[model samples]
Target: MTEIQDRPAAPLATATFESLSPITGDVVGIHPVHTAEEVEAAVARARDAATWWAGLSYDARATHLSTWKGVITRRLAQLADLMHQETGKPHGDAMLEAALAIDHLAWAGGHAEKVLKRRRVPSGLLMANQAASVEYRPLGVVGVIGPWNYPVFTPMGSIGYALAAGNAVVFKPSEYTPGVGEWLARTFQETVGRPVLQVVTGFGDTGAALCRAGVDKVAFTGSTATGKRVMAACAENLVPVIIEAGGKDAVIVDADADLEAAADATLWGACSNAGQTCAGVERVYVHDRVYDQFMSVLTEKARDLHADASPGSQMGPITMPRQMDVIRSHIQDALDRGGRAVVGGLDAVGERFVQPTILVDVPEDSLAVQEETFGPTVTVARVRDMEEAIARTNATRYGLGSTVFSKSRGMEIAERIRSGMTAINGIISFAAIPSLPFGGVGDSGFGRIHGPDGLREFTYAKAIARQRFKPAMALTSFGRTAKADQQLATIMTMLHGRGTTIPKD
Candidate 1:
């Protein structure tokens, strides 16, 4: 068997397996890890659902979505528990993510008609008499390959918007979180009384199957290497794709910043979810003036956080075992290159749980700074000024999200950064606004998954033009005369042949 097939859920037959708790290693639930055949079947069912869904008026779809939102709200605790069990995130964090997703769902459903309705446009002076309009049409079926981190919020960014835009969705959740995927689909089906949104669970192969299952578009979220593979797979069918890949996002602290708040935001951004977030702050550049103060505060904050399998644990296991090795390697690289660990260091990584780690004075080229460790580890560097901090922050190829903690220069530094979203004063708060677009640029991947842009990503632009009246001069037929041609030339000359002074009344 391939190395991927030998992972945690390898023995399942129909892409079905038991989800184990990352902390306790206990089997949480059994789920089906769908194969290509199941994905095709789900898509076939979705295609029929899409036809009916597309025929419905905007109000009708909104009503169904409202009902689904109510169902999710009623079972919020149940779903959050499943999320926490499968992904090993804090219960409050899981609930917060789910609540935000529901908010986006409501936003998408309420605003889709306004954002995508037909609108008139000028046809330019040459065709001023003719009327032209543009509208967005659904692309039929959309496939979403979700990640394990923030499983609900991330995938719903695509699924909720796709459905609001009158498209059916077939989602393949990460193997580690298939139970959450199934829970979402079940709730949706219960509310809508149709498989408008279906779930197919599996590892990467099942995700690959969804890409090739003839869907109109695919929205994938994962590592950069895996995104490339997903893109190549989708390219085989010429299907459009939206990729929300990984990031080594950085946080910048200026001389005018609040050292305590900066330390709090940085620690939360770095160690949250055991540091498995795509937009997690993995690197930090602090002004030299507050470097010592920020480090001292961060060390204290991180010390209070612990990764355990208990109910009230702030941090949990790494979820994926192999990721432990990568996290270790990154910390080791930083240490070997003369970096000092102010908190948990190389010994922080255990068999499952990874302790919160904070490294200082790490070389820029070290793996901790250059690669996505995706663990409870962060690297902090001291810079002379904001310019140096911004320059070093923008040097990485990944620009998914960043945090700026400057009181006076927050906006200035945020605009100069090469990331898609920048959270000033807070870490990753832009994701909650529902108005700002979220996605990365360059190697971090392209296309957005939230707000109006998310609604449009699952659709195609359709333009329509109709002639309002025939022109006064019939130049199409053999009716053109020399006098008419001379008149046209005179008009052209007066309008554009040469620049002229403005006429005085």
Candidate 2:
């Protein structure tokens, strides 16, 4: 008999913790801290479920996903409550994040059939007698390790796309936000009537277990240092990985930019979610012409923002405790290097929450400029021109995402910046468009999680060719003629055999 995947309530408490509110340090909820063995079990079940799920046609998979999306949409408020309790983010922010995730889910489900279905290709005159086609096949099971920042929107970049591509998912959310992960899996099971998606909650070790649990691929969203470790762990099983790592992304404002819009976008990009975003704007480079105006607007906006554990606060506590130290160090480094804190100063970092901070005149080599602070801190630097802004923005090893605010040269300057997605006249808005690929290069990691790239990431390309007829002069058999050989040479000469551009002897 096939055993059902639903677990008994008795074993739920094997891992327990007090999820605290970042603002008040009070227990919000108690969640399970799953073990490595538990994570392996979840993967094992997901692997079994994937066999059944992947066997369905692309259209059938789409229908199943649509049903799941409906469930998510209807019960979004309930899910958002759990997100709020776990991460201490504002309820509205959680809802916005969930809404965006649902949008991606809907897009992924509706489009996966078209993107992944087999398609025919031209065989060329040389192979006219043969039929050729390419199709994408599922990789069975995918393991996802999520981050606490933007919990729903970020991991869904992998989870939704993977499900749409017809692969089962085993997710291990960050230790700081396990309840949200559990809620998602629970709702998925209730709606789909299967364990196509499952959660294994724990800290880093549990996540590591999921990587080595014989899954075909691992999609990780976290710091760059942790991303490297995740890649190394997956390497043990030869598992493919897509890492969405840390970013020191910058916003470049040209002399022709609308200073008001640029300042607003820059402030939100650096302060939203307490600047816990992976692709959030950490630095701003404005042309000297409007530097003063931008700075004034930014500080005024920063002053109005507040970080508290309260439900209505615009910002929340740093989800991870250790990150507070990193935030403090960045502020201290900026201060020690003669940078002036235009708004919140060194005391901005609290036990769990970090207040909005704006610094100016920081040296280019300071930690605040070079490293990812991952907090609500922005270093505003004045650039001589757009060229200097582009150069300074590209100087970071991390190139996850960026923003540009220029009237005429927006796209031109944006394309020059070394990042994955660039938002013009906005901030981090490209991630909402399902057609654009999301991921980064260099230290920010490779492989995408949304769009067609996301659908293809969970699948491998399969090519098929079949001979339809025998050629007049068979090239592979012993029936070839001299005339055919001469014709082939003529074809080669007409193509790649022409005189080299370098003039070959």
Candidate 3:
């Protein structure tokens, strides 16, 4: 999910629409263009379904989710094929995406009890007469608007966690992959025997409708521009939203790093899935000591990769036709600004697929550097030291994810980057780890949709403070006296008035 997905179709009402294959321009699937009324109906049904679903114990819900996980695992190949037809990604990439999603679903189900369940907290001396505890309660229904790229994995980040948290979901998949959305929903219904998960297939109107459909929350993933619009719609109803939006992720390579490994990771991270990943590597900052050598290895590998309709090609066609213009414009902007293309340039932009492109010496303000290209393109810049590299890496307004390559300084460098997740000596490793929360800061959007944070994202905290005994000072009652107030002040002074120690990370 990133800046490269298809923008929403204009709000022209239609009965049905066809999902086309980007590789062949053939209709892959036809789905009804659901209306606002229809979307409301689905959410309404989800509201009822959520009540019953939430009533079950965490273990019972886990069992149901675990069963659904098995079903998806069994039909992994089938789902992969549907994804390939709709998103034009390689079958292997699709399979990997779905497989990771399954892992997350399993983790969400198996761990929700521990992460979201009620747990006791120590009552301070001031409140010693009470037994205090806190738990996360499910928001009735969550509206999930997913992106076309990595359709299965991205949406499930929200859908799976929300369900595991005991909320029903109304998923509105990208208009480019309605079939995939329906398939997920249909399979869940077959196993759960209810509307715990439902799909509403349509264009942007349907998504806007979901925000206003009185759902407890909405989770959105797309371009930053689209995210703002989604937030506005959700705000109309004062609904909470988790937006996993666009990113211009970067990678920093130090002189002490493994050059060959960094080259491979950079090329793969930049070109894989046609570079539509929200967390995909778009900018590279290498220590000048190893910049030339690193470029030699990176370009050599980039040359071996090409975007075609080959059944087994690791690089596939651009999923959205409209996005081609943005890709071309970014490339042209860098070139016009005096950046030299080392591997590919304007010629690499094709009708459907884009060849892996590497540009060097691009200005920091160039579109290819400042914006999310959402294409198989990368910009390389040489820096004098790790200090310069870190500064440049953190310069972008978008910080969804980042990578740092340094044998001794990997962890240190990773900690300094302004990204939600940083992979040190690895490529997007945080995504595969279900316990790590995945999201971004600044313009990359807010909130999270993975791990414990993800499970709580669709829930409201419920704090319970039961009275165990009468307090010496009745602060809440009118009977509270001046003497009691003095005692409270004295207790506060003793407990918190002095200097305190901050715990170390």
Each prediction's whole-model lDDT (CA): 0.89, 0.85, 0.92
Off by over 4 Å in 3: 1-13, 500-505
Better of 1 and 2 by TM-score: 1
Candidates arranged by TM-score, highest first: 3, 1, 2
Q: Kindly report which residue stretches of model 2 are placed more than 4 angstroms away from their true locations once superposed.
A: 1-15, 477-486, 499-505
TM-score for each predicted model, relative to the true structure:
0.94, 0.93, 0.97
lDDT per residue for candidate 3 within 1-505, as digits (tens), equals 4431255564565688899998999999888888889999998999999999999999999999999999999999999999999999999999999999999999999999999999999887777899999999999999999989989999999999999999999999988989999999999998999999999987888788889999999999998988998899989989988988889999999999999999999998999999989999999999999999999999999999888987768899999887789999999999999999999899999999999999998999999999999989999999999999999998989989999999999999999999999999999999999999999999999999899999999899999999998988889999999999999899878767885943232
Task: Give lDDT tens digits, candidate 1, residues 184-231.
Answer: 999999989887999988777788899999999999888888888889
- Candidate 1 Cα deviation (angstroms), residue 49: 0.7
For candidate 3, give the lDDT. Answer: 0.92
Please provide, for model 2 over 1-505, each residue's C-alpha lDDT reduced to its tens digit, 9 standing for 90 to 100: 0001112222444567555665566687676767777788888888889999998887888888888788989998998887887777888889999999999999999899789889998887678898999988889999998888877898899999999898999988776677788888888898778789999875666777888888999998887778888888999979999988889999999989888888889888898888888888899999999898888887887889889765578887776666788899999999998999989988888888888899999999999999988899999999999999999999989899999999999999988999988999888999999988999998899999889998999999999999899865577867788888998888767756756634231
Error of 2 at 329 (Å): 0.6
Residue 82 displacement (Å), model 3: 0.7
Clashing pairs in 1: 15-32, 15-33, 16-32, 16-33
Best by TM-score: 3
